[model samples]
Target: MTASMTGFAAHSLNLDHASVNIDLRSVNQRFLELHFRLGDEFRALEPQLRELINQRLARGKVECRIGLTMPPAATLDNGLNPDILERLAHWQADVLQRLPGSAPLSVNDILRWPGAVQTAALSQDALNEAALAGMRAALDELVESRQREGAKLKQHILDRLAAAEAQVAGLAPLLPALAAAQREKLTERLHEALGEAGHERLAQEIVLAAQKADIDEECSRLATHFAEVRRVLNQAGAVGKRLDFLMQELHREANTLGSKSVAVETSRASLELKVLIEQMREQVQNIE
Candidate 1:
């Protein structure tokens, strides 16, 4: 199924020692680009997280953020280092003896000292595993959101495709008659300018006009491209790039049809085709 390039998902989990939160957001991009916002403790997992995203998504600018909050119990367990506190006290006493009138080191001053208070190191492996699980869940939600939006986009494109096909079908029958009328008009003009001598040249002018006005090839190729687009929409993997290429092809055919238009009706049909193709192109830009 087709997928849109815009989506968001967030998940939070409370473990025994810490609370983990993961948030993922994505927007349209021509290629896969990842932005990570993680704490220093989790920086080592960046590569793993990126690999996980790459496995599931083919295109977009994706941002991932992870946060960990230690629980109250865990926070208390490692709030102070008694060994560092004793060392600081000894250093402070020595400094006071040397300075004679130095004030005693205050609690605030000791607390601010490096290594005086340090949080217990949590298990890196456990944190990594929990984060990976949370990330996977968040990614699943993100993909589902994109898929829902994709369904809507696919429907819109299919409707436009139908409209384009109808325009082509309407123009098909009118082409031969329109070309014949144009050729007849050209012959009358030639006769007016050259009289009887123009009769011999009329046949050559008619053939040339018919060739110039012929849109059968353009229409047929458009139909083929439309079919391919529908097939790509139904595909399971990333088909955004393929659909983009098809849109270009469709536009090229529409342009050719417009240039060759010899009647107001054919020109209107071409204009409508262009409008529909443009709409589809806009939607394809957000597809994956």
Candidate 2:
């Protein structure tokens, strides 16, 4: 199935003491571009996270943001650090002995001191596992999101492809008529300009002009390119660049068809084919 290079996914994983949150944002690009916005503590995960993303995604500018959200203060104060309490006691005793007029440290002041309380620390291994799990889930959601959008883009391109194909198909039937009419018009003009003195010249000039103005080859090439575009769209993985190349080919054929056109029918068909191909090109830019 076709996938797009644009999507978004956010995931949160709850742990014993905190929660790990991850957000993945992707946008279309010519090559795979990965960026990470991780907290200082989680910076170590970047290398592994980068490798995982590279393995899964083929092309896009992807942004991965990871953060840890701690629990409430009350929940975190699971116990008191005895070392901190003992250190505070020694400091207070020294201060009182140095100045008898100073008051003693209160229970509230002791509890409010830095490092007074400690919670069960989350191990690096646990944090890493939780973060990787969350990232895996987020990536899954991101891929699904991209696939849904890609389905829409594929349908859009297919619709325009049908219209362009119809234009090319319509051109083939009009070629013989267009060539005959152009030759007849040129013959009348040449006959009037040359009269009897240049009969052989008129015949040769009409034939040469008619041959140059024939758009049959251009139409055939356009149809062939259209088929190739459809074929590429159906194949798996990273079809955007290929489809883009085919769009160029389609546009080239359309331009040639227009230049060779000698009648309004062929000219209008050329213009419409260009329009449809441009529309398809716009959607193809997002496909993967």
Candidate 3:
């Protein structure tokens, strides 16, 4: 089944130590570009996360935001660096000896010094595993959303195809009548321009005129292209480009039909066909 290039998926996962919330949003793009927003602690997972998204998505500008919500229970003890503390103490003592009456460094001042306390370390492997699981779930949701939207787009295109086919069908039987009327009008005009003396030559001229204004070939090709479009729509995945090309072909045929129109009905049919093709083209742009 085909999918759309726009969707949104958000999922929150509660791991033993941390709760990970992932939000993924995508829109139509010519290529797959990913933007990731993650905390420093989760930076290690960026490459793997990108790889996971690339594997699932074929095209779009996808943005993924990862938020790690750590509860108070997950907070680790702030271990002081005893060696740095000792060095700071020695430096403070040396400064005090030089100034004799300088105030002693307070405990709060020592704790606030750079490198005095170490941040709690997390198990890289465990976090990586949890993040991957959450990411996979979020991606599945994204695909589901895209697929639902794609189904709607497919229906829209199919409806336009039906309308176009009906217009072509309506035009098919009118061609012969249109040509006959055009031939009659041409004969009358020729007879008025040149009297009975030019009857034979006038007949030849009418035939040539009818042949020049023939829309049979254009109408036939339009029907063929319509059939090809329906075939492509039913066949399989990633047919957006193919359908787009077919829409262009349909428009080309419609324009040719209009230019060669010998009757008002033919011109109207051509206009309707162009409208239907444009509608389908608009919807096809969002397909995957």
The numbered model that scores best in lDDT is 1
Greater TM-score among 1 and 3 belongs to: 1
> What does candidate 1 score on TM?
0.84
Cα lDDT tens digits, model 1, 91-174, are: 888998899899998878876665565645756787889899999999999999999999999999999999999999988788
* Cα lDDT of model 3 by residue, 162-256, tens digit: 89889888987887788889888988888888787566898888889889899888878988998898788777567778888998999999999
Candidate numbers, best lDDT first, in rank order: 1, 2, 3
Higher-lDDT candidate of 2 and 3: 2
lDDT of 3: 0.84
- Alpha carbon lDDT of each predicted model: 0.89, 0.86, 0.84
Candidate 3 lDDT at 162 equals 88
For residue 136, give model 1's deviation from the true position in Å: 1.6
In model 1, the Cα lDDT at residue 204 comes to 81
In candidate 1, which residue pairs clash? none
Q: In model 3, what are the clashing residue pairs, if there are any?
A: none
Best by TM-score: 1
Consecutive 10-residue window with the lowest summed lDDT within model 2: 70-79
